[model samples]
Target: MKVTFPHMGNMSIVIKALLKELNIEFIPPPPITKRTLSLGVQHAPESACLPLKINIGNFLEAAEKGADTVLMAGGIGPCRFGYYNQVQREILNDLGVNLNMIVLEPPDNHIGELLKRLRTLTGSNSWWRVVKAIRFAFAKCEALDDLERAASRIRCRELQRGDVDRVYAQGCQAIDQATTPKEIVQCRDEYLTKMRSLPLDHLKRPIRIGIVGEIYTLLEPSSNGFMEKNLGRLGAEVSRSIYLSEWVNEHLLKGLLPVKGHKLTRKRAQPYLNCMVGGHGQESIGATIEYAQQGYDGVIQVGPLTCMPEIVAQSIMPNVEKDFHIPVLTIYVDEQTGEAGLMTRLEAFVDMLERRKRIQVESGLQG
Candidate 1:
């Protein structure tokens, strides 16, 4: 089966590693572009959330590259994501695109069914071989995430505007090229060292910003208008609420393994939102509170337009801002969102944060 999957930051790297070890033939989708967005917008329902549309775009583009099967993840919450696979499949069918979608559901729900899906996807590969492939891919994911977190912090302080991004890309390339776990670690460490060694302007004191929102939007730069890089370029250090491996550990591995993902995040969100309203609603609330406690200058909540969970979280953010005394920016994106307009909002947010910091300093309060 020639399979393809949606893009979510560095997730494609993990998938490529997994498929390679399984001896599967696959067609990787082209990097997302304006044409991808246009194709999705042209076909998707007018009110569909941004992620589902972009996913359609990814699959359609991959189909053009001769992908006959689509590999997608499944969700279990009230989030509309739980239905994405079915909806996307129907849409493709209506368009007469002859691709089959295989969804890998969360291990916590219907473990037997999940195993069946995995068995089909892996074909006749031994269970042990499958396990090793997954373990190695997870290692790569962790290493990539470490590099990404470091890059976010260092990028804002780099003497050169794009040095951190360039080095981070090189680091990802190195990790992607490595076949073994040991090599993955080596590449990660080597690039991390290179990232640290990059010259920094000590005078540049970056504003610290926490990003929390829908997972797809938060993880996919193209979908969110490259918010992290833009924030870094505007002299802000960025930390996201979720990463792929962390999400897998907390969400997928919890039932199979002794994992308590987002335990503390859930606790912190107890005051404003005690339950999972869907998507990352509770997590977003919790993360915002955590960022405030950590003295972050601001928090940005990004999601697709009409997303229920984020809309719930966004409604409560003004109160969060009042209580925590940290600025919060809520950005909802759709196909219509323009990079220039998004950049303007980011610029204003940064300016407000800098002003707030100066005011605190003048008032003899800790900044």
Candidate 2:
């Protein structure tokens, strides 16, 4: 079966590597293009999240390319992602695609049972073979993660104020075509080297911002008006929390791994959440706390226009803001998102943080 997976920023490259290392024949949908957006916008309901639309476009493109099966991740709780596979699957069926769509649910959902069904796709039978797959997957993740971290630095120059998209495009294309872990490592090094060679140290740091939220809006530039990229242009070092490895670690072992007989983040974040609040709750709180502890100027909660898990986080964020004193901004992105609106809000937020810092410094001197 020729397998394909949906887009999730740079994660697609690593996932594509995982399938290849398994010796599974697979094809990736092309990069996000106006055509992809047009196809998605034409067929999807008007009110769906922008991410869902872009992905439908990705899947439809893959289907048109003769991919017989598509691989996707499943979700839980009140998140609409929990039902995305079902809806998108039916949409493709209505279009006469007759495609075999695979939704790999979280490990707690018994991923092994699903893996058994697709074992032939991996071309591995020995227990050691599965172990090997795990090792290779980790290597791919590490390489891809490092590469994106570097690209994140350069994207500031490329998409922000400087015009280096040609080089950025070269790096992104390198990632898209990377077939081996070693190749990924090379791409990562090249991206970092290119970024460091630029003339960027003259700009002052704006309010340092950390963005965390639903997977789709976080990754899709069109959905958020490239908010993080815009933040970089505003002279902030944008830190986003979502990557292929983090997702794999979350699904595979982070929750199950014991730290003094319980999950570390859950145990550590208890003062924050007494129980499982569900769907990235532990992460959102933990990352904010970490950023606050690390002295980040601010944190921005990004989510889909109607995302529930983020709404849950939003409910408790006041305490985080009160307790940590970190200026927190929430941006709910949708199709109607205007570039001008986002720019204004971000500028205002950054200005507030700068003023707050000055007030604190002046008060300290007076005391």
Candidate 3:
């Protein structure tokens, strides 16, 4: 079966690695662009969330390219993400697209079911081979995450405009090309070294911002108007709470391995939000608290217009702001979101942050 999946930041790269090792044919959807968004907006229900619309667009495009099987992740939460697969399946079927859709649910307590689903894709591949492929793919995933983290740091301070972007583009290409674990490690290190070598202003302490929101909007640059890159270009260091590797470690690997921080996240979120309000709502509150405790300059929350989880998080943010004294900007985005408007809001927020920092410094000096 020629398998296809929707794009979620660097997730496509990891999926490509996994499918390649499984010896399965993969038909990746075209890079997201205006056309993709337009197609999604044109067909999706008026009230559907942004991610669902984009995903529908992705599957439609992939189906046109002869993908017979679609692989989608399933969720178990009050968030609508839990119903995406069934909803999209109905949508595609109504549009007369004939494709086998597989939804891989999180293996919270059903590891065997998850393994069975995986085996269906691998076909005749031996158990050991499947294990090796998974390990290799995860290795690539970790490497990609490391490179991205470095890029965020380098982007703000690079002496040459776009140098970090250029190197990062090349690094993604290099990582995509590497097939072996050793090659992946080598490529990652080389890119890390290159990023470090880029001429940077040693004395420029950039405004540091933490990004927390719904997973899809937080991770997908196109969905969020490339906010991380834009923040860096505007001379701010951006740290996101969600990374694909970390998600995998927490959701998929936690059953097999002992993973930390989930409890800590819940504990930190206790004051403002004590329970899982569905989706990443609790995580958003927890991450914002963590960032505030870590003394970040500000936090930006981005999510689809109707995302319930983020809506819940957004309502609680005012209390978070008051208690933590960290400025928080919540941007609700959708197909109608305009770049110009987003840029203006971002610029004003950055200016405010800079003024706040300067005022604090002056007050300290006077004291």
Candidate 4:
């Protein structure tokens, strides 16, 4: 059975590694584009969030490429994401697509069920082989995150625009091709050194900006209009609140291991929001506070239009800005979100941040 899955930043890399080890043939959905979004928009409910619509488009594209099975992650929360798999499945059935969809839920208290699902997918592959594949794939993901973090740090400092991005892309490509953990480490280090050695404009002081919001929009560039790279190009260093491996380590393995479960972040949010508003809402508030205390110039909260959790976070952000003395910009994206408009807003935000920094320096309030 050929398998397929939605794209979420570097997640496809890990999925590929796993399927290859299991000796399973898989069809990866094509990259996100205008046509992909169009296809999704044509069929999805008008009120559905952008990520869900894009997912439907992804599965349709894969189905066209001869994929018969889809692999998706399941959720349980007040967020609409919890019902996405079932809704999408029903939608596909209505469209007469004969694909079998598999949903992998977090093993919160269902370790035995999770293992049974794994066995079904892996067929007769020994548990040892499956475990080894997961380790290798996870190593690749961790290495990629390191590369991404380095890129974010250096993007605004590079003497030449896009130089850091170019190196970062090459590093990701190398990691994706590396077969062994040693080689993965080599890829990360070799490219990291290269990134550090690139010429930098030391005279330029970049505005420090933290990004906080829904996981899908934060991780998926196409959904967020490539906000991180665009902000860096506008002379801001971007720090994201979430990454793939960290999510898996905390949520996916929570049942199997002892995880802190972002205790510090939750603690920071206690003053403003103490309960789970679902779908990273509390985390977004916590992360913004964390960034403010760290002296960041500003924070941008991005998410899909009509997301209730993000709406709640957005409502509370004015308080965060007032209490922390940091600027906050909320951008809610949909099929109609224009890249030009998004860039314009980012430019204005960065300009304001720079002016604020200048004032602080002149008044002897900042070093």
Q: Which residue pairs collide in model 2, if any?
A: none
Whole-model Cα lDDT of every candidate shown, in order: 0.89, 0.71, 0.88, 0.88
lDDT of each residue in 59-98, candidate 3, tens digit only: 8899889999999998887999999899988888888998
TM-score of 1: 0.96
Cα misplacement distance, residue 101 of candidate 1 (Å): 1.3
Query: In candidate 3, which residue pairs get closer than 3 Å at backbone N, Cα or C atoms, i.e. clash?
Result: none
Provide the TM-score for each candidate, comma-separated.
Answer: 0.96, 0.84, 0.97, 0.96
lDDT by residue (1-367, candidate 1, tens digit) is 8999998899999999989999999998898998888888888888999888888999999999999999998888899999999999999999999898888877655556666788879999998898788888888988999999999887889888899999999999999999999999999999999999999876877789999989999999998999999999899999999988888666655445443367789788889988889899989999999999999999999999999999999999999899999889999998889889999999999999989888877887643
128: Cα error in model 2, Å:
4.6
- How good is model 2 by TM-score? 0.84
Q: What lDDT is reached at residue 9 by model 3?
A: 90
As for candidate 1, its clashing pairs are: none
Q: How accurate is candidate 4 locally (lDDT)?
A: 0.88
Tens digits of per-residue lDDT, candidate 2, 1-367, equal 8988888766676677677667778889997877887888877878777777888898899888978888887766656777888888988889888778777667555647546645645664565676566556666666656655554555544433554444555776676577666776787678667766666553544456777777677766656777866777666667776655666666654433221222454455568776665566666666777778778889888887766667777888889889988878988886567778889999888778778878877899999
Output the worst ten-in-a-row residue range by lDDT, candidate 4: 252-261
